[model samples]
Target: MEIVLKKGTFLVFLCVAILASAQISVKRLNDPAIVAQHKRMTFESWGDWRPYPKYFLGIQTNFAYATVWGMWAPKINRDYKDGDDIRPLKSTGEQNLRFAQLKFQEEEVKKIKAASDTIYKRSVQDLAHWTSATVDADPLWLLYYKRMLKPITEFPDNPQNFMEWRLKDQQTFETLNSTGTLKRLQEELDLIKEKYTWSRTMDMPRGKRFIMFHETLIRWRIFVQELRRYNNRTTLLLDYRSILNSHLPTALPTQWTPTSDKGIVQNVMQQYKHKY
Candidate 1:
């Protein structure tokens, strides 16, 4: 009698559970809003499950001395909105260029500061070691002492002049590298042409020659490179901001989630998938 009663109760509970599930299915089928909200929520949840890049702005800020001030680009299909027009992924070279430029700027700035410090230090050494007549005769040493001793901001009132100085310096190096310019500069000299070469200019003592060709040109090149780099950075930053502001259509259509259909509608489509 006890066994019979337990079997009956179990049957009743199974019936009630089946009925509850049926009621839920019916309500979902009748209510389109519920289905839509479910799909939207599912898609959003999928984004939460998405993996982050191995390295990003947060990594740079926390681990490196550098920080990105510009808008980080988002992958189109991954970071989607209701009608966002997706843009194609940039070419590998173009994609890498962003980080490369940032690193280049950081290193370039460090090099400039180091060069400035060295100039001041060398000037101090020269003043101590050399006679007053010799020290006074060397105008470049005096200039370095004066310039590096002051803060960079205090020394320059005109930005345009500073840029011009950079351009003038670049022109000097290019001119020196031009054909029929440096008779000693041989084509097969086995020197690394891209980077700065001290082998050629190091032995040339710190006088008018060194000031005109080496010190002046190098400083100017730094200024020009960094100035152009920052200007380019400004353009990229503004463009990215504009992209964020606009709700324009992206390149790709929004990907629908698994539940993005009305009730068993997706099941019907799946049945035809193999045949198609």
Candidate 2:
């Protein structure tokens, strides 16, 4: 093949080829004082010479190759053990934060249970008063007064607690001096139902405590409801007495949740360490 080239282009190509093939050398600056002086001289006017493309490219290439060969290589993967997979422990600051959150949750549960206990006491007292007063005022009050009194006496709750339980039955109270025997009893039942409905609507905790609290509340309602009907209907007397037997023993069943003083702290540390 025939080729044509300008004289300047041919000369440039020859120089490049010679530079690539030859063992080139740079003569050191002869004056030791000049070299020493240059080391301290600021080159701010020319910006940074160390950041030149060639210098940076060489540095980056060396680093990339070193990283691959020394760290990311297959030999490193083979040498790694299961122990290496485990994470280190958490920092003191992070442990404190997790423990703080756990404490907050615990306090929240405490607050809820406290509030639930208050409502529970109020409801139980209200039913107790209604049962006690109605039994004493029944037309057949004398016949079974002693029989009904036996359960109330043996129950764990104090009669004094029922003193706080006032009349919430507006209909029964307004007609206290006028309503018929069965009519007053029915309205009183409505009052008991009102308290039961309120208890059912409450947002109680979801644990063993919840079951015990709800069951006791329900049994109290059943006992009271049976008492209201027993006077007019003798068949309900046995059911009324039976509910009392089941309720008295479990009158205040409390679930004791075991707690660890260091649990929150330990859990926080584990979570921060990625061990959780």
For every model shown, the clashing-pair count is 6, 0
Worst 10 residues of 2 by lDDT: 43-52
**Candidate 2 C-alpha lDDT tens digits along 171-223:** 32332223244354455545544544433344332233234334545555575
Best by TM-score: 2
| Model 1 C-alpha lDDT per residue in residues 78-128, reported as the tens digit of each score | 345323322222233343566678899999999999999999999877654
Could you report the Cα RMSD, in angstroms, for every candidate shown?
A: 49.1, 31.7
> Which TM-score value belongs to model 1?
0.19
TM-score of 2: 0.22
Model 2 regions lying over 4 Å from their true place: 1-179, 207-229, 232-276
Q: Candidate 2: how large is its RMSD? A: 31.7
